[model samples]
Target: MAEYSLLIVEDESTLRRLLEYRLGKEYNVRTAENGVEALALLDEEIPDLIISDVMMPKMDGFALQTAVQEREDTKAIPFIFLTAKADEESRKKGQMTGVDDYITKPFDIDRLISRVNRLLERTKIFQTQLDAKIGQDFSQKLTPKTMPVVSGYTTHFYNVPKGHGGGDIFDWTETRPGTYFITIGDVMGKGLQAKFYAFSFFGYIRSTIHTMLGATDSPAALVAGVNQALVNDSTMEETFASLLLLRWEPEHNTITYANAGHCRPILVSERGAEIVTYSDIVLGLTPNSEFKDTSISMKPGSALVVYTDGVSEQVGKSDEMLGEEGIIKVVQNAYGHAEPIDAMVQGILDESKHPEFDDDVLIFWLERLTSMDRQTPRWFSPFRDVAEGS
Candidate 1:
């Protein structure tokens, strides 16, 4: 049986000891003399929930709540204020400060314990659901359960929900060793209808990529075929997408990319980060426009990060963009040596000064192939003719 820990902060010795004694029967309880002491304890280890007196010297409950709310780690911790003040103003202030609940000083022990347990349970459930939703969306890939053996080149995928699910799809497939194809498309509109449109567009793009695997169609012609397909058939009348098609060839250490009204792909290399942009209009809107493809030689230890407009155009806490520069800085600081890929992703989110995302963010990291993996495929038969003759 695991014990749920509870932290109690009260300036009065009698109340602190009494509450700790009663609650300690079921929970592992720790008491603090005041907010300052409680904060110090928090530094040592986080408690499942916090129950604190409203008034105290060297940091009142209000001040403590404000402080905790300012930090991301502490903000979500359930807060309950134990106060003697029954006045409307004090209660209003506590409510405004976003304390989960308030109990008058002469409180009922059973009720307090019950509320605390409930809060913790609800928090766990919400987080569980969030995890489930993310898992369900990215159904195909496991999230880096094993650390990437090679450093630098890795791809990260995310599912960002737009209103009612519009036309946004991003995918990556390894066609051959050291060769990968990345596809991103934004369908026009929001909700289930838009999601339907996006799904169709994605299928078309995926099929086209597969069909053209050994064929020589430039990115523009690929887009033209997709656009013409959508326009030619009335079933996809509502679908229009800003598409980007990119291929990374490990053999030549090069990246061939083309964009159709999509955001530029930023490369984080040994030389630092730089954006690679080329001209191509949005797909599906026009049927016969020519598009050009561009290519770049990849450095051995570089990462090509691509995203939908969501990330590049996101508005941060200060109302400024979590721009390309911000993303680059975050990636560079977190992506040291060969840590686990999930660590790198979480690190970026942790470094994000603000928590809000104005738009969906998708980050893909393409690391260069290490020497070990760049070897020739062992299963290919070079002596098939000789064996047949014999």
Candidate 2:
């Protein structure tokens, strides 16, 4: 688990030091003399919990809390007020401001610590629940597990769980005889909301793909339709998605794919493995978007890997990131090995295990160039975000 950082914002230097010393026993604590100093600290790094005095020189605790609530990044951090005034108006004002907890002057050390710890724990629990919801929403609406006829080349997926549910999703459907439409997407955000956005984007892609099958049967048109649909949806205005829509035309022995705000697909051939980075705004975040399609002819032994940021973001135990270069190195090392794509993914994941995940991870491997009349991707329901778009 990541260490919780507590920020103390009291004007008195002596009280700040005493509180920092006391809280440092349990949490990583930082002290600031006033709201101005506290804001400066916040600009540097966000603390998990903030303990501020109600009265101060430049920025008071009330003003700080209000500012925090107004900002998107800081609004979620828990806030607690420390006030010498114990009047009804003060208490009511603090409560109305959504103060997680309050401490009166001459507070018992043990009592203050206990309250802070409880609030911190509660904040953690809320974050966990939110993340779980995102995963559930994605799985419910658009998981590949739910599909009947799998699309594209056949490859087993490795189990690489993100501590929180992530925004990565991949699905497929057949457009014609010996031709399959595959879609992969990553939604912006963390936890369930990310998953929710993924599902919404997946649904739009599925419906649009189906419609395209009856219309032009062009990969570019299909991508354009999907992008327009997502752009038109008001619910997804704040949320954006990166997508790669692949169409396998076996008759031509070629695969054509269009990208929208998604990472480029990689082709692992006998010669070498290279990333293909052709992408155009993650859908919904922009309008009147123009997307481009790329074509690649596959050899018999060739394979395609579509992955989320998680695969590239594998963190080591020492807080070191296993970046894209590391991922490419791992992939290069696995090449020509007897291991299947599943094993390759698992090996990468095994090499990248940490105590916790910074974000959700997903790896989708597509094998073979020929047709496999297998099941496609399935649907998962969206978690209703009560906070917004409710």
Candidate 3:
């Protein structure tokens, strides 16, 4: 259950302390001298509900209500007007301002508490519904499991939400012929906390990628920018994210990539499979952190397998983890026969064992085509063609 937070806005000192004492037992309470102080507090954090005096210096209850209702963030916060006046006109005016209830002064403490409880209960229900709707929308945004044509490469991926519903997100774009950008990240937290961070940072990265198109060839710089963006968000103090960024250049026949505390990607070819060991600090954990790039020359028919911990840490029938070494073994066994991109994934999952995943799972397979297989166009919309298949 969410612990309710109540902001009491009253200019009078005596009643403010009394309300705090009475309400603090059942809810977290904050006190403000007037509407002006309340607005200042709101800039820091919004409360679940508000109780405000009708008459006050600087800003009155009606004025505060009007201001709160004008904002998208504060509009739905349950509000109650505390007034000494009981005139019908005043009550009607309070209702017009979107006040949830009006409590007349010299009010019975018990009745006031009852009204507060009911409003809080209703607000909680409304918030849960809103969260569910928004979560569904976020799921849609993260739904792409595969991308389309990227010159001489094919891509495939999978996303499986955990029981608590975390998001393991990935995206890629070929900004120009022979140049490509790809990114994958696992968001911290679970359920609503995970959804909030997942949606928030997804937008950040999406916009950042667009802004970064053809501007620089450094994947490390983009990862550093994403890290700085997370550090700038005050709410991300306890949250951290792990991500990987990749940029492919056909002229050099090489891929430049960086990892920010994410699981390493495995490279598989006729020579065998090996994990790329590049590493850096996780995003949102360190301010002004540095991430270095690792470049690899691709052999024809080479395959790259990238996945979140949900696959690496998955428990098998015997409760053993399918760790990085296990992933290496799986790739080695299938390296010769594996297709560059398949709905089954660039790699196989059941070979890793299809155990019940305890967290969200994401796996991406990227393959550089051999000369014999390079028949497709230079580029196409990966999202429009392949995302629906997965």
Candidate 4:
């Protein structure tokens, strides 16, 4: 019994009043005298559906529909036309103008209500399917954003899209008891197109992990397998991906990981922080690339900040980029913070100075916050505070 908002845009007061009276009981309805009034109402608050008269002063129904279609924000809203003529030409024109439903003059109240319900239900179903497609099962999709909870770790992910799409992929899923596979990758260049490359990469990771259930589930092997698959993919010949793959074993309290031409992740713990790096070429660009594995003990009260170049290479006002050292400073400055991950990112952004980011930024982590029992050496306490007291 959710109350959906409906907008009625008719110049005639009688019909408008009738619709308000009829639909008001079941829906949160608003009335507009003409297309201009409808546009004004749209500016104030977007209704779920728009019901507009075909003929009105200032702006006609066609003009209003065209304007709505032009504006990015309002273009997708479901629209209906209320016309006096029930001719075939008018119906065809309404369809051409992308009208979702139509109601002719002398229409029955029941017919109008039924059409309204059908359109709203159809739109709801479409939206549900779209959401599901964006984040379907067996995957942690990162289109809009993704934050997942896995036992034994505190996790957070932040993604700032550069445009319609820039190539940044992040996925993490538990494989078996106390084991997980996480990946963060950036496809070369920006502006999302095929997206097939990124999509294929995720598929390969999951399949490779499952295939290696009893054999190998290490980061190096998984990344190497992905590289081979990408090399075999003809569609990705013109592009390459820089990826960091990680495998966490909670039982062993260890992380075995590898990099494919990606920035090293910061391992922050009681010993302060150290960069975990490995030598490997960018995936797909080179043939027969071998990525070596590096394993690190998951210290009690430790966190790992895994990210792409967008974060580590954030440009500042001085034209100096906040590189690896700068990120480390941000982390140090964010120490003892209630939300250390967010504080650390804000510190980095503050250092960058610009109100907008030039590239999509992602700051991700797998963490266990600090405890008094595990304290770093007093000498290692202060290295750099990128944005302290800001």
Candidate 5:
């Protein structure tokens, strides 16, 4: 029942006006003399559907359709071609451009209206279904349902996709009691395709972790394993991903991490916030890429923060990005709050003032709790003792 907008591009004044007057009764109609004028109007506002004539003075319907298809915003709009030439060649050309319909001159007005209505309705249905599917997939696959509970540490994560879905993914597993392995990555691109690709990439990462968990505890080795798997797979040969792998060993009070072209993690302690500088090439780029691990000792009350580019690249009021420096400031400010992780996430959101992000936003915070702050029961003590060879 939503009133759809339609653009009619025809050189003939009488026929254009007649179609507009008739179509205007059921939907919003706008008329243009040729494809050039139609494109100008499109810059101001995109219509739900476009009906264009095959021949015109400045730009014809085929040329106009190509121009519209070139833009990301206007490419999906339903298009119909109207023409005096009923030749098979012209019809084939229009079809090649993916026009919704082609009607010859002396076409029935009633038939034209019916085709327009059917195309618009089909488009609406398709969009609705796509949105629903993306929403469902995002909730079920891309994000963790609950924050991880690790002994001697407070762990929290926050994620918001740009729209219905995004490319960022994060997951954690308790390799052994009191020891955790975490993986965070961003697939290259956006929207539904990126979301699905991320799922596939994460699947490979998970399988690598499970198969190698008993063999080695090195993050760099695990990252190299994942990269090799991706390079070997024909389906993922062209896919690129930035991965950050971290292993938290509470017994050692240290975090061992490896990066694959991902953003450097921020370490906040008595020395102050500083970026961890170790990095390597992204996954799926080369077959024999090597990843190096960096180990950082964490004192009680210290925290480590990792995030996707969306957080650091957020545009501020001055049209500048809130880069790593801005994120460090936010993390430092959140230290005094009862829930530092939640406060840090909120601080970034308030600073950006963006209701929706341009890319997928993800923040993962891990804080080593001081002895005085340890209130939760230690459920991993048995596993901890075994890991320590006691």
Candidate 6:
């Protein structure tokens, strides 16, 4: 059986010690004399379950539960009110406060233990199901279902989500004829929570792009619009996301890109592979953040590679990470291959020596095919009205 941790907060010294001693046998337990001490302990380390008294000096159980529920880090911890108050009003208040379980005085220790076990087991099962559902949704929606076919350009992307989903997200759309807008981002966490945040953040990105259509064509302006929206939203005040936006113009053979604390993209051509040099603060940091766009000229057979940190941070067999420099090497080696994007992914997997990555892996490759190379017609239309000759 797994050893779960529990926190017991009670005013009575004898009762606190007795509960701790009994619960300690099945689980690791910590005790506190009052809500203040319980909060202090919580700051140090969050426990799986919190059993607290309703009445105590300094801070009462209701106050302590409010504090715990308000914090993002501690809000999810299961709570139980074990107190002497057995009134119907007290139980109603506990229920309103969102206590997972409530036990009155003269409670049987065996019954209490059983309730604790059931609550913990239920929480574990709920988390597992939530992760599975979120992972399925991520696989279906977070990544592009099909690569857009642009005239004079060949596009390819690969996304491998980590266990139960991860934070990486990417999207692309043709803003105008011969112009394509692409955005890649990574939310600042992992697993189901990060995946949830990624979906929300990506929604903001898409909304901003559409809201600013025809108003601005600069990548920096689009990124700034998204940042402003994120920072101004109270719910997203604590959420931070690294974003990279690119505007590709096939007729001009140029790409104008803006980075918001994201990994710099690599530009691979006949000469060699090199990283694009431009970046700014991440989104949700501040509304006043400034973003700048850098334009780079591309030649035939040239390609741009944008990816999440998962690729650059992969730990290799040497126990060292495959940093940006290693990524450049992978792109360079894969250049000119019949399937360069697949070659790059295989090279990365070979170096990592892992069947799957620890973080979500997303890679977007855009190549300006040469005249001699086979070309495909543009079949993707961003606007139905425009496609229908309206």
Better of 1 and 2 by lDDT: 2
lDDT of 3 by residue, 306-327 (tens): 8888777776556688788877
> Taking the tens digit of each residue's C-alpha lDDT, what string does model 4 give over 1-390?
347899998999988998999999888999988788888999999888989999899998999999999989899888989899889898888899888888888788899888898889987777656644443321235443445555556776677655434467787777786777787887776443424456666666668767866787778887888788778878667668888888888666788888888888888875687777665888887779999998888776788888778787789878898888987777766655668778887787687768666776776777764444346655555553433524
**Residue range with the least summed lDDT across 10 consecutive positions in model 4:** 135-144
| Model 1 ranges off by over 4 Å | 1-153, 160-166, 174-178, 337-358, 369-390
Model 3 lDDT on a 0 to 1 scale: 0.80
Model 2 segments beyond 4 Å from truth? 1-110, 126-134, 146-153, 159-163, 316-323, 337-339, 346-358, 369-390
Better of 2 and 5 by TM-score: 5
Cα lDDT tens digits, model 6, 1-116, are 45789999999999988999899999999999888999999999999999999999999999999999999999999999988988999899999989999999989989999999
Model 4 C-alpha lDDT versus the unseen true structure = 0.77
Q: By TM-score, who's the top model here? A: 6
Tell me the TM-score of each prediction against the true structure.
0.52, 0.62, 0.60, 0.57, 0.67, 0.70
Q: Show model 5 residue runs off by greater than 4 Å.
A: 1-125, 375-390
Predictions in order: lDDT: 0.71, 0.74, 0.80, 0.77, 0.86, 0.88
State candidate 1's TM-score: 0.52
- Provide the lowest-lDDT 10-residue window in model 5: 375-384
lDDT, candidate 4, at 381: 51
Stretches of candidate 3 exceeding 4 Å from the true structure: 1-134, 212-215, 336-355, 374-390
Task: Kindly give the stretch of ten consecutive residues in candidate 2 with the minimal lDDT sum.
Answer: 372-381
- Model 5 alpha-carbon miss at residue 96, Å: 26
By TM-score, is 2 or 3 better?
Answer: 2
Structure candidate 6, residue pairs in collision: none
